[model samples]
Structures are given as structure tokens and as C-alpha cells.
Target chain A: MIRMNKFIKLAIATCIIFSHSSNLYARDKLDIKGFLTIAGYHSSNDNLGFQPHLSSSDVGYKGDDEYLTLSKVGLQLNYQLSTQFELVGQIVAQKEVVVDNSDRIKIATLNYSPTSSLLFRIGRFAPRTYLLSDSRLIGYSNNEVIPNHDFYAQLPLSYVNGADLTYNFGLSDGVGTASIFTGRTEVNINATDGNTLNSKFKNLLGFNLEYQTNNWLYRFGYTQSQLANSWEQVDTAIQFLTLVSQDYPSPLVSWTEGKEFVEAYRVKDKWFRYKTLAVQYDNSIWRVRAEIGDLAADSSNIPKNKNAYVSFSRTFDQFTPFLTLSAIKTSSPRTFSKPDEGLVQFLSAQSNQNLAFGLQQVFQFAETSAYNQKSISLGVRYDFALRQDIKLQFERKHVEAIGSNLWVVKDFSKIKDEYVSLIMFSYDRVF
Target chain B: MNIRILIGLICFVFSSVASAEILVIVNKNNPISSMSKQEIIYIYTGRLMAFSNGEQAQPIDLYDGSQEKATFYKITTGKRLSQINSYWAKLSFTGRLKPPLALETQQAAVEYVVNNANAIAYIDEKYLTDDVKVVFRLDS
Candidate 1:
């Protein structure tokens, strides 16, 4: 089970205090707002657990960790320094299963707008890679109790220390916006040894284009970055293979060629590209949203994957019921050599089977770790009062064998294709 | 006969309250005479911050969940108050934009707009005064 940090406890207390008080900080030059979500989730299976995002570690909403799966609180401060320049800072304490300073401070930026159509911002800000990337933490702002895990959990990058420029114009009786950003980022993920794996991204560049009308919004976005750090596990395996290649006694099979294969599949220092297209339609009665995205990399360790989801919600006065279907699949699945392969056979004949097995397992460890699942969820949102809402959702997910990477499992050997049911409830409020 | 008369009087009161027309108002010196429905949407939603004449505009709203606020969004954008709040939440949290400045009551909204030349707001037609001019109207 994951331990709750002291910061999260303090955040909950602050939220409760803020909720009971009026907007005492509202002023002409400064405004303060806070949001809170008290949530819990339960999973059907005990063998596997659920995480909200890919970067989250192995322990999640199962066993004794159910209560901490989704509860969170956040506060934002906006100070208008001048008519043309403003400063904004927001802090959130949630899901700090692995506490990192960067993740807690979601946005800290200085904004400048010379004209109504052009704007600039610099500091730590979220990259708008998806429709909801920037506002993912505000549970009260979203339509679903939980976003599509298959789609949102694929990429762990949330905020980037960056600067961006945005230009808005009128087009087709709608408002069109074009934005470009450049920054560097870090993503902390679960390591195979139950530790944290830090992935550093450098020279990141991205752009987003959007057109929004009264009832419809269309978006297209793209981003590319280079991995700045090596995958330690894979790198160690490659080094071991290189040593074996130089020491092999027999020339019957070229161990050097086997070493080359591992070298070619390494993900370190590789370039990654991602693209997304999304659309949303809302008439205050029916809300429909759909999005498709793909992440591509040249290395085998980071396989190319595609994810998509469509959601529909209809409002009935104070109640809104929603249905969503989401899915993800690896387009280029990673594969590893078996003992029967030529390299393994040669190594076995020389009585170095342990080395061969170790190499095989190391290569396969990351290969088998890919997200491939289909999920459908039905939920209802009840606005019990202004600025307060409660939601309950039921989701069924079908996970493919060897594709339970998004889930934390007790035993990798026991992994198989199975259906998992999940129930989630959350109370969200903003003040 | 007395019960029927009481019921008729209650119906009249409720219908009049429901049928009141809403008028979008701005400072009389804003230089803009009238606004299109789309422009009003753009302003209230934080999409457009300037008038068609290139003058900066500030939009104001009645406090959250107030009857006048709900009726204004319903008539203009066909959106419930919750939806509008959700939309504003997305923008404000991003630090990209903020919703219109909220005033406690219809009278407060009128005073806010009247005191600021760039300000815009909406209120019931019965509250119309010389300090502010009607730029758009929504009939119930």
C-alpha cells in the first residue's frame, strides 16, 4: 500500500477550511480559488490494482490503498500585476504516492497580453497535448468521474518548465487559436525493482490548434522530444551482452550479432513523437466528445501505441448521465528471443545458459510491459448544489495477456487476459 | 369560488416572474450601440475581450446560481449554470482566462457596469436606468 504524505493531509484540511468560508480573498488585484475532491474506488480483482496515471507506482486502488486512489485538493492564486501582465500560481497535493516537487506545483506562470488576440506566458505550465491535459486535476471541471485510463494513462508527462505564445483570431464565425510551446520535462514512473524510474525529456517542442464555437470545439496537437536519459535496466543488459560477445569461445554463431540486436533496440537518446485530434460538442443538453492519439518511437522498448475514446453525456436538469468507451493497442508489439533462438542455442551449447537466460528475461521484461486494454464506463453526475457535485461510475476493462502494464499485478507469471470491474465515487467542489 | 381566485392570483405572480425579459447593458459611453448574440456569447464566455470597435471590454455577472445569472446564461447560450461554471473552471485553472467578474445582485451588476466604461452586464428590463444602455435583449 502507498503511504499518505503529510502534504496531502494538510491539503485536505485546507480545503475543508476554505469550503466553509466565503471568498474572503477576492480583491480588485488578486483572486484566490480552491478545489477539492474526496474520492474512493474499488476493484473486483485482488491480484491486480489500478492506477490513475502511468507514472504512478505499483500500489493503487486495491487491498488497503483504496481510499487514496483519487482524493485530492488544490488551490490557485492569481495576481493581476498590471492590465497587461499577470502572475498565477497553483499548488495541488494529490497522488503523491511518489512525492515530487514538480508534480505538486501544477502551474506557476507570468502572463502578458499586449492585445486581446495575442498572449505570452513563461514558467512552469502544462503542455496542451490533449483536450484535458491542463485541467486534469480539477475534478469538478471534468465531465467524467474518471477520465479514460487507457488514453490518459499512456503518457506520464504532465507539466513542463516552458514558455509559450498563443494567438487568437476569428474564423468561420468561431474563435481560432494557435499556440506553440518549448520546454524540458521529467516523468517519474515505476521501476521494475519497485523503485522510481525517472525519464528526462529535453528540447521538447509542441503546438496546438483549436477552433471553438458556442456549441463545438475542435483541436489538433503535436509534440516531439528526445529522451535525455538512459533506461538503466536495458542499458545494463546491453553491457552484459557486449561482454559476452567479446568472451565467447566458439565462432559457430556470431555472438557479436546478438549484441548488435540489443543495441539496436535500446530506447535511450531516441526521439519520440505524439499527435492527437479531438472534438467536443455541447448544447447544454447533450455533450459528446471524442479523441484519438498516437505515440511513436523508433526504439522497441518504447513501442508505438494508439489510444482513442468517445464519451456521451446528457443533462437532465441537475443530473447528467454519461457513457464512455475507450481502448488502447500497441501498433508495433515488442518481441524477445526465446531459448530456441540461434543466439540462445549457441550460448547454451557452450554451457553459458545462465547468461543467455538473463539476457532473454531482461529484454522481455520491458517488451511484455505495454498497455493494451478496452474499457467501457457508465456514470452519473449530480449537481447537488452550486459549485458542488457528486459522481459515481462503473467501469469494466478487458485486459489482454501481457498487456496489463497499466495495472499493478502481484505476479507477472499469473498475468492473463481477463475482465476487471471497477467502481468509483467522488465528491467534488470548488470555492 | 374563493379558492379558484387564490389559485389564479398565484399563477399570475409566477408567470410574470418567469416571463420577465433580460437586457444586456453596458456603460452609456462605451461607444458601441448594440451587440450581436454571438458577440455577447464571446464576451461572457471570455473568448472575446474587445468590442468590434477595438475597445477593450470587461464583462460582469450576477453572483453564482442567482436567478438572474441562471436566466441570463439560459437565454443567451442555452447552457445551465453548472455548465457555464465548468467551462470557466477549465479556463481559470489553466491561468489562461477568468470568468466575468461576479457581483452579488442585479443592482450590484448594474452599478459595476455603470461605473466602468468598458464594462458589460445583463439584468431584468425593469431595472433599466439612464446610467447604462441596453446592447442586447432576450425575451422569455
Candidate 2:
């Protein structure tokens, strides 16, 4: 696996260098464009740690301190070798909240266009899961400084390493596009104990369909993947549970005493599915959009969630004022289950109590994987210059959960059914 | 002054400001004589980068904050200046498309359109010249 990753990196580097040298000699065919976003926000609570999306767990402001963690810069290079072939690459640098800042390649793809209506891309590319998936990192491309967190926060992966095919056709009086992509990607899972575990997603398959007319756009997308269980923490925790179960007298009375039972409880390879629908209408003066989505996993450990958001904005001269209402609800399959009646009857009262407590802890851990949140955001953007804008936003978010606070970073005890207010300022420009 | 006369003067001033006309032009040698509103929208938004005859099409624009540029996009594409900028910014990074080449002035855009057979541009109707053929018109 490491060798394959290295090979891919080397190939991308070679392509970039060759393209650059050719462009230096030939010129005009190679295009270099970039975007920058500088943003800072303050939250009402300390260590708020509000991750806007699952793939961006390391983003957002940390604590009550105003931070630049959301700020990012990206550079894109496009080398059109010919009308039929092209090389495209983009790199982004950003400071991750509670994590070290890093520069990473967002996309590096070799594109082939057999005709104007069809295209193929092979390499790393941002999955077109949402309306703004490709340009989500470029704040200047969006009307709001940040997309609605409730709807986008559940997506766990941003890019896939594989191939994508897109076809464009005419539908009635509108344009229609259909795209299919399949690939695999590795995800970094951050544990509460300051540990990071690597997990792999295999057999990632997705398709997106879109139709657009003069003033209206509609999109539907579906994706599915197999998530391989590889977190070492899960293994270690199971080991500890087995050791503790040895104190019990009989297998029936002891929790985790049976290998089969333990294996059943262990995290296993599960199918993750996502579906989304989006619609937008713009008429120069007013813009309105709405999106609804569902994410589910076949395993009990993972949570199934539904999210939706609606936004409206109006443009007056150089200023745009926007408002959005978003919400997400999570349901976990790991509901608390009582031990077998026979085991409970045979075990001592103290042992039964201990067994129930252990079961509760295990289920709680699984349930905390998801969050229930709703937020309303209001913002105004000022087009101060060409291709440049500044925005200010205020959001009031309500988090509702039991046994765990999903959005808070630290001191979960301090979190309850509370409203968290956040203020943000951002400036973005493109060149 | 009389109230009726005052209101009439205000209406007249506003009508004149809102009635500015923008003319879309292509090189005189280009085969395309005229284009529909929808076709012009597609070309300006970078969705259709070539003409029906398969000739490469290049769209040019006046400087960013120019009223003519804003009015043209608003009436033709039904998009605000900021929205248009946002749209192009997203496509530019994806390498799927590029925004129109922006010239410093309307005269520069007209001159470039006159020289390039494949180039198309928009300027105030008052700037129309014989060197270029008007393909579409939008009145703000």
C-alpha cells in the first residue's frame, strides 16, 4: 500500500514538473490560478471545537480564542497539452484546529476529452457529492463565508483516488450532466485520547446527476462504500474487556467471555451509503437554495443521520445579505440491551450490576459517533473589489444530545442543551 | 416646485439611468449573425466555449466594476456581478473553464473583438462600430 501511494505521488510530481517546463518554453497553454481565504471566528464557549464537517474534524475555532484555523490558500495549475488531453493539479495549505498546519495536494488528475460532450479523469479528484464540492475550499466561490455546517458536517471523505467519467446531454430545454466515479481513500480518525487511527474505505462508488436551465438548477447524488475496520483502539479495548471477563465464574455469566460474542460486538466491515438532493434558483436579484441528505451505515457502531438546509439571499448593488436555517438528526443502532435472562439469573447481584455497567459504557461510546444539531446563520457580503469580497456572519447553534456532547472539544460536563453563538469575519479573493 | 412636477422629474432621472443598453458583438467575419438570449448566456458563462460550427469562441469583458459589464450579465444571465464572479472563481480552480478575458476599457474589448474572428464581447450600445457585428442586445 505504501509503495502504491509513493508511486502515485511520484507520477504526479513528474507530470507537474514536465508540464511546467513545457509551459515555460511554449507559454499561454499553461494556466496558473489561485485563491486565498482569511477567516477568524470567536465562539461563546471555550474549547468549542465545532467541526463544520466530518472530513474537517481538525478545522473550526478552538476554544473562545479568535483563530485563523479556517483560513486557507490554494493554487491550481492547468496544462492543456492539447484539445483532447490536459493535466490539472491543485494544492492547498491550511491550519487545522488542534492539529498541525499542513500543505496537501487536493487534486492531480490527467484528463481526456474525446469530444466536447464527454470527459474522463484518472487520479485524485474531489468527489462531486455536493453542489460546491470542487470549490468548497475556495471561500471566494461561495456566497456565504462558510457553508451550512449541519448539512455538510456528516460527510467523512472529501476526495477519492480513482477514475471518473462525465457525460453532458441536452434535456428538453436544459442541460443535463451525469457523472460516475469509483475509488478508494484512507481516512484519519482522531480519538478523544489524542490518538489518530487510519481507516480505509474500499469499493467507493458514486454517481451524480444534474440538470440546469436558465434560472434553475437541480442535482441528485448517491454514493456507497465499504468501510474496513482497522482502528487499533477498538482491538485494544476488546482485549481489556476479555481480560476483565476472566474474573467471572462461568461463560454465560461473564460479559465478553465468549470469543464469538466478542467478535459480534467488534467493529466490522460495514457498508456506508449517502444520498442527497439539491435545488437552486437565481434571478439576479434573489437567490434561493435547499438541500436534503441522508447518511447511513450498516453497522450498529456507526450512526445514521439526516440533514437539511435552506438558504436565501438578495443582491443589492455590491452587497448581498443571506440567511440560512440548517439542521441534522442522528440515530444510532447501538441501543442499550440487557444481558440474557439465563445469564442474569445465574450471576450474583454484584456481577450482574457490573455487567450492565460495562454494556452501558460500550454502547455509549458507539452512540457518541453522531450529533444532533440545528443552527440559523445570518451574514452579509460586500463586494469591495473585483473578484474579491468580505463577509461577516453570526450563527446561533443548538446542540441536543444525551450522554455525550458531540460538538464540544473538551469539558463535556459543561455542555448541555445550550445555544452557542459564533461570530465570524472573512475576506476572500481570487487571482 | 409643484409635487406632481417633482415626482415626474425623479421618475425621468431613474428611467434614464435604468435604460442603459448593452450590445453584444462578434467579429464581422464570423459566420454567426445573431444569437438567442439563452445562447448568449451559455457563451458568457463558459458553458459553450465553441460556436455551432465548431470554431473556438473567446468571450471578452470590460473591466470588473464597469456598469456595462454588470448590466450585461444581469440582463443576459440573470446573475449579479458577484454571482458571476463566484461562478467563474469556482470553475477557474477546477480547470473546467475560464472566465472571459477582461480588457481595461470598452474600446479595448471592441478592438479585440474586431481583430479576432472567434472573439465575442459586450459594450455599451453607444460604442457600436462597423468593425464588429452586433449579435445580441440587453437593456438594463
Candidate 3:
């Protein structure tokens, strides 16, 4: 992998040098573009904080006032090396509410198209995982302040390091495209407890099929990945459970035994699969988009889930009013049974119940994996000037007690099935 | 009867002024004689990069905020200029395709077509010149 990375870097450098040397007088060969979004949002609840996406840092909008959690700027460059080859790069700058936040390259790829119908790209680029995955960061291209959280929050991954091949052909009255991509990526998610958690995805593979007519687009995709490293917090809890179980063994109840529990929730080397189907229709007046996805994993800790969302919008002159309904539900929920009363009493006699208390905390940690929530949003976008628009949106949500995985909370025990309301305003522009 | 005829005449004039005649043009040396509306739409939208004859195609557009530009897009795509811009923004950032080069006026568009055999552009009928060949026409 290290050698391959070095090779890709060298190839990109070579393309840049060749293009500059050959086209010294052709200034039009290199095109530069940029986009910006300045947004502020406020949530109604103070107990929990809201972030635009899970991959973002934990510091976000709280109840006290509006926060700058949704503002970012990006610049993209497309260098045409030749009729058949081009190099593209993009960088985004935004505030990272956590430690070690800095601007990074979002895309750096060398694209080659030998024929009008076929294309190949190598280097780091956004995989065709969803309809808008490739353009997720460009707020000027999106209708809402953010994508539907229920559907997009589950996968915070944006780009991968590898290559992809695409073939598009005219089918009937529309175009049909088939693509295959493979890469490896690392994801950093700030846990609700303020700890930065990292997961490495190895052997990542995915394929997508799309058919787009003048007014409608349909897509189907499948992606599979394997976990390259163990989750730190989960591992620590499992180890603690095993140590306590050794001192207080429960012969009658196997799950209460540490070894059995650890085996059930172990996620290392496990495979995770994602399948999605989406459709979109747009004309001069009305635009509609809908998508559904299913996520499956080998370990119980990574519970199976199904998520869906539908968005509708109508354009009237320079104003567009939109409505979106989204939901995510756990298909498989894990439950933990406490140790028997006799075992609790025995632990109290030996260790003053501190070990028993630790065991209970471990159970609570396991239950956090299952998430459930639903929300509805209404927004309006006004094109006040050319190539610029301002949007105002309001959202109401209902989160099942432990399903607050999407939000940052210090104490999980205080979470309850509650309603959350949020309001956001943003100005988006492109040049 | 005279009053009704006057009102009808005014409506006809207004409608005529609302939608003007637009023409799709290519260089005179280009072998292609004509193109369909769908093919033109595909080229302008960056879906198809080559002509029917497998020759590379370069599409040009009028700069933003022009009346003729807005009307042309409205008649061809049935979409507002802002929406079309947004769509291109998505495609541009994804690195899939780039939008056509935008000239300042129809005269520049015609000049661009005259210089490049593979270039295609749209202009008002008034800008018609002998240096370019008309491949498609949108009548009011």
C-alpha cells in the first residue's frame, strides 16, 4: 500500500509537470472554481449538542445560542493535460471543533477517457456510494442546509484512496452508467464522551448502476468493507468484563460469563455491508428525491439498520420551498441481562460491589450501538443575487432514548425519548 | 369587433417578444448538417462529448444574465438559469465533466464557432453569418 501511494503521487506530479511544460501559453487549459457556505444554527435543547454530521467534532450548536458549525469554503481546480487526460484537485477549509483540525485535500485524481463512453480515474476521489456523495461538501450545489441526517449520518466516509472505472452508454432515451471502485480509508469520529475514535476500513469494494433520463434518475449500489482494527472503548470494556467474570463465575448463565459476552460483541476482522436504492425526478417546477438503504454487519455490536428519506421541492421564480422526511430504525436490537441476584450479593461480600458497578457500566456501553430516530424538515431558498442564495430551515426530531448516537451527550443515562427542534440559516455562493 | 381584434394583436406581439428564434450553429467546414433537440441538449449538458460522427465536440454558451441566454435555456431545458447553474456546479465539483465555455455575446459565439470546426454554440437568428452553418433551429 505504501508503494502504491508513492506511485500515485509520482504519476500526479508527472502529469502536472507535463501539462505545464506543454501548455505554457494556453492559460485556458487550467480552470479554477470555488464555493462557500456561511451558516449558523441553534438547537432548542441544552442537554444534548447537535452536529451537522457524525464525522465532525463534538463541539457544536447547543441551546444557548447560534453556532458556526455549518460554515465552510472550498476551491477546486481542473487541469486539462490533453484531450484524453486531466488532473483535478480540491481543498476545503472549515473549523474543526476538536483537536488537530486542519484543511485537507478532498480530491486529487488523474482522469483518462480514451473514448466518449468510457472513463478511468486513479488517485484519491469520492466513491460512488450515494447519489450526492461526490458533491457532498459543496453547499452551493445542495438545496438544504445539510443532507438528511437519518440517511447520510450513518456513513461519514467521503473519499477513498484507490481508483475507479466507469462506462456510460445511451440506453433507449436515457443514459446508463455502470461503475466499480475499490480503495481503503480511515474514519475519525468523535465519540459522545469527547474521545476521538478511529476505524480503519480495509478491502473496501463497491459498485454502482445508474440510469438517468431527461427528468428522472435511478440508482442502485452495494459496498462491503472489513474492519482492520478493534474499537478501543469496546475492547477495554470487554477486558474488564472478562477480569470480573474470572473472579465471580456464573456456571448457570453463560452470557453473564465474560468470555461469552466478549465473543458476542467482538468486531475486529468483521465484515460490514451496505446496500442502497435511490430515485430522483426534476423538471422546471418540481423536484423530488427518495432513497432507502440497509446496513448489515457480522458482529452484534454493529447492529443491523435500515434508513430512508424523501425530499420534495417546488421552484417559483427565484424562491424554492422544500420539505424532507427522514427516518432511521434499528432492525436488530441487542439486550443485556444483569447478573443474578445471588451473584450480585456474592460480589458485594468480596469487593464492596465496585466490580459489580463496573460490570453494569459495560452493559450500558454495549446498548449504545443501537440507534433510532426520525425527523421532518421544511426549508426555503431565496436567490437574492446571481449564483448566490440564502436558505432558512427548521427541523423537528424525535429520538428514542438511547438512539441519541447522532448527538453529543456527556451522560448517556440522562437521555430520554424526547423531541428536538433546530433552526438554521446559511448563505451559499459559487464563483 | 375592432376592439377584440386590437387586443388579440397586442397579445400576439407580446408573445412573440417573449420567445425569440434561436439557432444552433457549427463551423462551415463541419460535416454534420443537422442535430436533434435531444442531441443538442446532451452536448450542452455535458452528457455527450462527441458528435454523432465520433468527432470531439466543444460547446459554447453566452455569459450569464443575458436575455437571449436565459430564453435559450428556458426553451431547450425547460429550467430556470439558476437551476441549470446549480446542476453544473454539482457536475463541476465532482470532476465528471465541465460546463461549456461562455462567450460575452452571440457575435462572440459565432466567431468562436467559425474558428473551431468541432465547436458548437447557440445564438439569435439576427447574429446569423455566412461563416457558420445552422444545424438546428428553435422557432418562437
Give the per-residue lDDT of model 1 (tens digit) for A1-431: 54567645765677677765434367778999878887777777766667777676435534554655577787889899998999999987666544367578888999999998788999988888888888887888987876689899877777889899998877778988999999998888764235566788998999999999879999999999988988677777776566555534444445545554566667778899999999999888999999999999866677578999999999999999999999998875644443235555665567555676777676676567677899999999998777778999999999987677777777667778989888888888788
What clash count does candidate 2 reach? 2
Q: Provide the lowest-lDDT 10-residue window in model 2 chain A.
A: A18-27
Every candidate's TM-score, chain A alone = 0.90, 0.82, 0.85
C-alpha lDDT of all candidate models, in order: 0.80, 0.72, 0.78
Question: Residue A10 deviation, candidate 1, in Å?
Answer: 4.9
Evaluated at residue A308, the lDDT of candidate 2 is 93
Rank by lDDT (best first): 1, 3, 2
> If both were scored by lDDT, which would come out higher, candidate 1 or candidate 3?
1
Worst 10-residue lDDT window, candidate 1 chain B: B60-69
Residue-level lDDT of model 2, residues B81-101, one tens digit each, is 777878888877765555777
Better of 2 and 3 by lDDT: 3
Cα lDDT tens digits for candidate 1, B29-134:
8889999999999888888788888787889888775788898898888988888877787788888887788877888888988899989999988888889999
What is the per-residue lDDT of model 2 for residues A1-431, given as tens digits with 9 covering 90 to 100? Answer: 01223333443444344432211122347777777776667767554566554444353343544434566666788888886899988887664422223227778889998766678999988888777777778888887777787877556465688999988765676778899999987666544333565668899999999998988999999998887665675675566455444435555655443444355455647688999999999887898999999988775555688889999999888899999999888865544344454554444363444544555566566656566878899999998776678899999988764422235456555555667788888878776
lDDT of 2 at A388: 73
